[model samples]
Every structure is written in C-alpha cells, then in structure tokens.
Target: MTPPVPSVPPASQPVFPLPCGMVLRPWREADAGVLVAAYEDPGIRHWNRPEPETPDSAVARIRRWHGRWSEGGAAMWALGRPGPDPAVGLVGLGDIDRRGGSAEFLYWLLPEGRGHGAMEQAVRAVSHWAFTDAGLHRLRICHSVANPASCAVATRAGFLLEGTMRGALLHADGFHDEHLHARLATDGPVLAEPAPGS
Candidate 1:
C-alpha cells in the first residue's frame, strides 16, 4: 500500500510582503470576482484554460486549493495590498512530490499589476519558504518559451534554466515549448530585485 502524505503542521496561510505597497496573502472567497475577471483576460485565458463557468465556481476552485494545503499537498497565495480587495494575482505550488522533495511553482498577475517587480519578489519569498519552512529541497517552474516575461521572472527568482521541452504546454491557440527552470535548497540566493524607479 502507498504511504500517506507527510504531515506539515495545520496552520493559517502565510503572507509575504513585497516592497512598494504590494504583498502576497491568502486567497479568500471574496476574491472570486477578481479571479474571474483576471481569467477573462484573453492572455490569461489563452495560457490557463481551467473552466468552472463563473465567479461562484471560482470560489470553489479557491477552496479546492485550500483543501490541498490542508492535506500538505501544496501552498497557494493571493497577491495584493492589505485591504478589502486584496487579490490582484496568485502564486502557488503544485504537484508536490514528497518522495522527490520537490514541487512545481506557478503564478500569474493581472495586467495592471505588471511593471513592478512584485512577481519576482513573490517567487523568491515562496522559494525560500518552500526550502526553509516547508522543508522542501527543490522547486521547479516552467513557462511557455513564447512568454518571455515569465521566463524573465523565473530567472530573476534564481531558478536555473534546465532546458526547453518541445511543445510541452498547450493553450487556447496550440502547443508551445516550455522552458524548465529549477532551484535547489543548496542554491544561492535569487537575483536581486531592481531598485524602485529603475
């Protein structure tokens, strides 16, 4: 028989702070509308094709992420400043392989939230937590090679480019090559965030 997933302590979600009035916090039911709206972006929908139909269904999806967290399966975080409406994006881990001591990291931000280095900082914070707090040894991230912005983020977060997997990811348009980037617990700190106004 297969052994059960390891027990990480049952706890509240963590909020990681970033500079310039940005933070990464837990997702809430109220954030469903933002999620729905973000997905409605043609770019987002083209890349991420999960369909649950409406904002209400999006809440179910968020709850499902929390369920995975409770089971020590993955950790998910929402991005925004601390306020009534705090979900501008999401960053999370998936396919956590305990036996392999690794997990796949993913993230997305609304168009308005772009320009600032928030995503890079968020990714670095999450990687550190996964290595130190979560006791995971390796984290891997991959994005469509066509998405240079994502590739830049992964590199800035100190994920080393392993290689390109030909046509590894599919979107609304078609298949695209994926660039694999990974970081190990023993790896050095991630690339430094750019100074404000750079």
Candidate 2:
C-alpha cells in the first residue's frame, strides 16, 4: 500500500533566511513576473529546458507548485531580499522521496543577481531548512557539467560531488552528463561554518 501523505504546513509559511539577506518563503501569485524574468536569463537557458513562460503559463506553473506543497510531496519558495521586491530568484525541494527522507534541489537567480553569491546563500539556507524544518535526511543537487557556475554553487553550499550520470539530460545542444552533488543531515554545520582560522 502507498504510505499516508505527510501533513501540509500552513500556507505562506516562512522557510528560512540566507546570510546574504534573503528569505525563502512560499511562492505567491505576485512572484510570477519576477520568476519569469529570472528564468529568461541566458545562463539559465543554457542548462535546462527553455521555459515557455508567458504570464498565463507562469500563473499556471505557480499554482501547480503551490498545489504540490499542499499534497505533501514537494515545497517551492521564492528567494529575495528582506523587503518588497524580495523575490529575485526561486528555489525548491523537488523529486521528494519522503519514505527515504531525500529530495532533489533546484534553483535559479535573476540575470541581475548572478555572480552576487545569492544563489549560494539561497542553496545553503534551503538545504539547512530541508534537513531541519522538513526533516529530510539527504538532499541532492544535479547540474549539467557545462554549467560550472551551478557546480560552484553546490560546492559553496557544502554538497559533495557524489558522482556523474552519463548523458542524463538532453538539452537543445545535445545529451550531456550531469554531476550529482549531495549533502546529508549528518553533514557539518547547518548554518555554514566559517573556514578554519577565518
């Protein structure tokens, strides 16, 4: 028999705050434009499938993301600075395996936000929350080898390179190998410890 669904948390819950002054909160309808703009970044398009993100499509996608949270399988959040215009990016725990206490993580930053360390901060914050608040045991972050920036983010967030999946994703260019990085609940420093002698 399939297991009972996990209880859904209240709507619009605040997940956690990143050190770089952003908060990860539940996605809202208002986030569609920001999300679409972020996804439109050329660097973003280079790694994943292109998003056909018209306003209507964004609205539908946001609704679907929210619905998944209610179903107890996945959670998506907007990452932004502390006040209004806060959502400069999106992050989520996807491919949830509640039975195994594991999940996959995905994230992207707005074009303007790239290279600002925002994505790294967001990844660390979300992974910490997933391992703690969400009671997850392991989190995986997979990225195409062509996207070294994404690999850098995973490394900065303390995810160790676990392995590579040969030809795991077929992009517009061609099939590409993907590196799978992972962090576990038992891993060091939930909040990212300073390097030795820092």
Candidate 3:
C-alpha cells in the first residue's frame, strides 16, 4: 500500500495597522482612484517609477501584489483608513534577499494625507510587521537627495542615514544623488510611547 501524502497548510496573510487609525490591507479593485490621486503628487512621481495609473493598470498592479503575497517574503499593501472610502496609499517591502534576510521599503500617500504623521506611522507599522512576521533582519529605504520630505520620513521612522550614492539615479530632469537609509530588526520599534502626563 502506498503512503498517503499530507496537504500543506495555506500561507498566512499579514496585515499591519498604524496608530493613526489606518489599516494596511490587501489592495482592492476600488483602490484605483485613490492610488491614482496619490501617485499624481509631483514628489511621489519624482522619486519612484512612473505609474500608468489607469483603472486597468491599477487592477493589474493589485493582481501582482496578490501574487507576490502568495509567494511569501515579498509583499505590497494598500494603506487604507477605517471608513467607507479606504485605500489612501501604497506601502511595501520589496527586493527581498532571503539569504541575507533583508528587503527594501517603499511607500506613498495621497496629497491630502500628507503633513500629518500618517506616513511616519505607517512606515513604522509596516517595518515592525515585516521584521516580526517576515523574519527580516534589515530593511533599506533609498531616496533621491532632492526629495527632502522622503528623507525626513525615513529618519522619523527610525532609519539611519548610512550614506549617499553619488548619481545613483537619473531623474526626469537630471542625475541625482541617492540617500540610503536602513533599519535593523534589533533596533526595536521606532515610535516611542508618549511620556507620562505630557
């Protein structure tokens, strides 16, 4: 008699939420509009690859995110606040190196969602989840030097500015220096608790 084969359990889905009352969940078809609005920001377009941004393109991107999630380790999530209309931005850990247990972090929020601590909180939340759930030892966040806001976000999220790569990326206008920042799992949570009776 042949031995029976056991079925493997399905992989677990990971979700992270910010203290600011936003939840990081899987992207949905309806997220296209909010995603387009967020990507339309000049600062976002300046640092990352240009997004096609049509409804079809958004669906395709969401499908890719689902595929990546199924594969494990590498993942992308839509940042949505708790409300009828959700999914305000996108954040994820990409460029995973299993051997080194490292990955690159990426994120963007809608223009209206900016100026509040949303991005910073979201980054910390995602980083904590990535480190704990994915067993990532380190995460890198690189940005163009011209984008100071991104640099500030990295710093606020407890990433250290390791160094700069001269002319690492060529922007629409010209070549620009790249600022490399990193956060280690050993570093613990970036957002500290409020002091007693502040």
Candidate 4:
C-alpha cells in the first residue's frame, strides 16, 4: 500500500545525535566500504543475509536507500562518530505505511559499534523521530526469535512484545520464528535522555 506523503520532506533528512559522540546520519558514497565490511562480519551475515557486495554494489545500495527516502517509503541512516571512516553501523525505518501511521525498524552494528548501547540508543532516537517528526503513530521491531540481543534492544526502546510470528523470517540456517514488538506514539517515554537538541 502507498504511504501518505511524508511529513519529513525527501530533500531534508534530519541527523540525530546519540550519547558518547555517535550520530545517525544519511549514508554517503564514502560509506560503501563500511557497508561491505558489515556484510563480511559473520554475525551480521548470519542475521541479515546480505548478498556478497563489491564496492560498486554497496554504492548502488546506498543510492537505492536514498531513493527510498525520496519515494517516502523509508528513512535509512548510517551510525557513526564524526571523522575519518565514520559509519560503523546502520539503522532505519523500512516498510513505512505513513497513511497507516506505522513503520518497521531495521538495524545492525559492527564489532566496534557494539557493546556501547548504541543500537538501543539508535532505536530510541529513530523511534522518537518516527513518532514525533515523521507523523507515524506506530513502529514495529521484528527479529528472529533467536536474536535475543535484538529483543533486548526493542524492549529497551519501549517496543512492547506483541507476539511471535511462526516461521516469519528465513535465515541461512533455516526458517526462524520471529518476535514482533511494537510501540505507539502514546506510549510512555523510553528515551534514556532527550535526543540532542530536543
């Protein structure tokens, strides 16, 4: 189904700052290598099932992400600290149904980006933007049931567990049950702290 026109215009995606010097910003061509590297990590590969990526394919993927934003179907961001070799992770809203006031969250972090609560912070930041700035009323975070880390992130971000979907995602290992978690605009605040400049 078609999403309604996005409240956040395509030309102006906002950057959100997290604690400890991280930020969620739009992906750049220079980030293609990082995307390729993420796909190389066993943990990410096992969970995300990314196609083998050459630099060209990674750049194409980044451009497609930009197009999705322009089409008002998604908003994707690269997670990183400012400086050389910035993006170490990715987080975003996908499958957005703006008319229905809903979207799904997607994310992953590299080894360097892990263990710092960055994923949880990124989720909260994106959820805040989805609800407040994007005019979305509901957001979902669904992951393979085996992915307890994702479950924790979703829960910490205030997305209540709704239920499990049988065989919802097919991983390289096999079909896996998926846990569905959701949060509403009216839900109590889950942010550990206000987003920068909030």
**Which candidate leads in lDDT?**
4
For candidate 3, the per-residue lDDT at 183 reads: 95
Per-candidate local distance difference test: 0.81, 0.77, 0.75, 0.87
lDDT string for model 2 (28-147, tens) is 777778757756777767775657687778888889988888775787888877666747777888888776788898888776566557777777777777776767788999999989
Greater-TM-score candidate between 1 and 2: 1
lDDT at 83, model 3: 60
Off by over 4 Å in 4: 1-10, 194-198
Which candidate comes out best when scored by TM-score? 4
Residue-by-residue lDDT tens digits, candidate 4, 33-53: 998898899999988777899
- Measured against the true structure, the TM-scores of the candidates, in listed sequence, are 0.90, 0.87, 0.86, 0.91
Q: Which prediction has more favorable TM-score, 2 or 3?
A: 2
Ten-residue segment with the worst summed lDDT in candidate 3?
A: 1-10
- For candidate 4, the lDDT comes to 0.87
As a whole number from 0 to 100, the lDDT of residue 149 in candidate 1 is: 82
Tens digits of lDDT, candidate 3, 13-67: 5666676677777777788776676667776777786574977787787778777
Which residue segments of model 2 deviate by more than 4 Å?
1-12, 193-198
